[model samples]
Target chain A: MDYVLTTNALCKNYRHFKALNGFSMHVPKGAIYGFVGKNGAGKTTLIRLICGLQEPTAGDYTLYGINNTDKKIKDSRRRIGAVVETPSIYLNMTAEENLKEQYRILGLPSFADIPELLKLVGLEDTGRKKAKNFSLGMRQRLGIAIALCGDPDFLVLDEPINGLDPQGIIEVRELILKLNRQKQITVLISSHILDELSRLATHYGFIDKGRLVKEISARDLENACRKCIRLEVSDMKVFTRVMDSLRLEYHVLSDTQADIFTKETITRLVLSLAKEGCEVLSLTERDESLESYYVSLIGGTEHE
Target chain B: MNKLLSANFTRLKKDVFLKLCIIFMFAIGALLPVLDYHVMITYEFPRYIDESFFSYTSFMVILFSAFCSLFIGTEYSDGTIRNKLIVGHKRMDIYLSNLTACIIAGVIMCIAYLIPYLLTGIPLLGFFIVDNISTIWIFLGCNLVLLIALAAIFTLVSMLNQNKALSAVICILGLFVLLMLGAMIEDGLNQPEYFEDYAYMDPETKELVIEPSTANPYYIRGTQRQIYEFLSDFLPGSQIIRLSAMDAPSPEILAMYSGIIAVATTSLGIFFFGKEDIK
Candidate 1:
């Protein structure tokens, strides 16, 4: 019932371009909200607006029950830390120094927590190596460490795993989970990489062209994206005839295609189709992923 | 153990621009007197000596005013500002911190910037060398503060724009306009019409004469009398802070009160700048 973030008809325009067009979303407290969208779908724009980098042209948003326009919004913002698009770290500074600079900027009393925060991000051993010399994963962790300087309860990360190698990706992924699990930090992560998002998200909101198509919990999404057997046949009428005769649970997709939800062996189904005088063209199995589910919601042809 | 890292050596902990400005200030500061000597020995040009500051405060002020905007503007242009703001900081804090850094960097400029120039005047200037060293020092100190104040004000302005080059252009143009406006206002106030003299003085006698007539008995010269009167109530530093880079105060020992006023005024600007949002 407690929502950490809520937006109502939030809109933003850059010249004639609509960066956020009536975007509305709710992030429940303590939930890892995965903001699923393609590139240029207003994820970063919305993050920027929420972070106060830019103001919304119309509508309202609330953080921790405090409205964006309230005087206490500053105090509310203190609870949220974001890495917008890329980690903003001073490449010339060491990870420790970067954390200290951030702490000073946030007006925290002292640097007592610097080492521990760096340790939390797994950048503790990076003693005097400047951030510029850091590996991509190290830089990202340092950036996250900088975000953690104020002890924020909510973390907003934009493409946090972008451009990382496999090992680096795994490191960052683990770090996010650790922070969220141990510290109880609610995370709002925006990423185009849905497979990875599916690995970490507790909840999801799919956006296309600045409008949220669906907002669903992971458990519900799993049920909606259930696995099924896809079939390509010589004739759909015959395919449906055999399926209807068998009383199987299925869907007729096209003249040449159909999908069955029932667990039937391929050889048995092949013989069954043959008896109905329908030849099997091709058969494939599909365990629906977030990407396909998104495609199902807002259909689009393959991009890559 | 954290204290093992020396705070002085903790210079590593500051912004690159702030560090570069300080380093540039001292380097220039150390080289100034020697450069002045080079100019004097080779070119036989007269050198001006001001001891109130480290050395070359004017040159430092000019450099700070021209370059500080670029440093602030670069962050906005590269979208680095978004990284800072997203970390739970209000936009106002971003502006204020950068502004404070700029002005404090200005003070550093005051110390190291003038000492070298002051040393160049080692022996003394000849008769032709207009020797108002004390007043010039006072003026330089205040002028440097004013320059930093201007830099602080421009930091907020520069961040208003997204393009670094355009922001730099607008800031320079804006500073020039303010400087000109301050000058024009002061000049207009100083230039009084004699014929339109105040009530206490007789109009016929005190009126500035445009023509040789019995009606207009007095002819105004330039702006000295009015300037002299304004000079009594106002410090040369206050006038300099106003913008047009007013004429230096009458020859006298530069006092701490004027320096305090200059620091106070410049500090106010930095304070306002610190609290403004970047975008």
Candidate 2:
């Protein structure tokens, strides 16, 4: 598999606090990798480490095959564009002016692409309006626009939609998808909004307490959260016997509750259970959601 | 680096505070000469015209502080410094670029004041009023060096801090404190070495009576005087006051001190800034 970014036991500490502990993740090329972690779960810390804003305390990471400690890692970073936490921008500068500053910083050949960049991020009409006056969504888009200035192949956005309204969230999502598909840019977006992330992420890395609990593909997550039927039966022993005889795959949740994964007609299932002297009190058709899957992986109370 | 410098200058052109500061410098330049002309006409006082030309240096210290602090402070508050690093520009390059731009701003402001002062002063109060013809030239050179030093100090203060308002306060307050210290030291250095005692004939006899002579405690003597004098030349504030007075100021020594300050502060600023963690 071709990966644009990968980490091996990446660790970072702030004095006595461990921000990132043995965090290892992989972002495949052209994949919208969602980094799922609660607040203070080292999502921003990992972003900072990779973006070269802060150095790792121990372990290391590779960007496009260059190790973090190598002097040439700076060259590797040339391929990355990041909007960490809040967008890094000059509030005094207008949208176009901000991008021009970024262009100058990148030593681009000309300002020829500034307009196109603004257009790409849907800020083409924000003429002479300073970034300070821009709405939260517009500022976020401008931040994304600035990041896209150097045409980086990999974009790392930390909490890209933290404070955006629903519309703003949708716009950012579509922009990310467009960038990944049309521009062929690999995106590593860390967001805690699991449902929203489910719509876009091709892969996921679930982190808890600075450790990656699981790394799963979207298809695999869907398969893991496949459709199942939850049943509350009168007798557990009879329910198991009936399910065994029927050869239906299921998981026992409690003495009286069980989830059946195999598909069968509702009439047929009730009839089969009745023959085994099992009375179904309640039955529910259920499909596990991403939130439950994440909870299951991390295995704890809500941290959000 | 050239790109960084160019971009900084481009930004500086649009900086409102710097524009206001330049205008302020010019206003002072035009006003100070007229004030000197008034003092000369009203009291026939010996108005030092050459000294009046460089009166801008005294105010440039605080003006430079405000300009340098707020200008660099924006980078921290806005988080634009990370952008430069993200684009692969060296930290040293960014720091030096900012320092250079501020120095240029200081120069422009100084000239903005100098031009108006000379334009008004020479016609009203006459030129070359001082005995030494080269004092004005040396004073101008010293003022430039002092500006460099002041720029260095303010740059260090501003770059070390991430809060814009706090940085400005520190820079401004730092200039004021240095000014007070410089004035105190100059006052100490100006003390007399000895007290003179006079003798007069007594009314009872045809004889002279000698009064008691005492040592001047305020007089800075020996190594202490040397230290105070060296300090007067070393401190930017002291240099400002000294240059304003034009008290046989040595252009070479002032330039050397300013060079030391510029190099020292810039090196330290770059080192700390390179190690700083950008949010």
Query: Which candidate leads in TM-score?
Result: 2
Tens digit of per-residue lDDT, candidate 2, span B144-170: 877888888888888888899999999
lDDT of 1 by residue, B1-279 (tens): 122122212333355655676678767766655666668788998664432233343345455665657666656653556655664454555555566555656666566555543454454432223355454455555555455445555665665656788877776676556545545545554553554433354487995545432333333345854564454324432344342233445422223434454456545644654443344
Q: What is the TM-score of chain A in candidate 1?
A: 0.82
Q: What is the lDDT of residue A158 in candidate 2?
A: 88
> Given candidate 2, what's the lDDT at residue B272?
94
Q: Model 1, which residues run further than 4 Å from truth?
A: A229-287, A302-304, B1-58, B77-80, B119-138, B163-279
TM-score of each: 0.69, 0.88
- Per-residue CA lDDT of model 1 for A15-48, tens digit only, reads 7988788889999998899999889888988888
**DockQ for model 2?**
0.57
Which stretches of model 2 miss by more than 4 angstroms? A229-263, A266-286, A302-304, B129-135, B195-214
Instruction: Give the DockQ-based CAPRI class for model 1.
Output: incorrect
lDDT of 2 at B91: 77
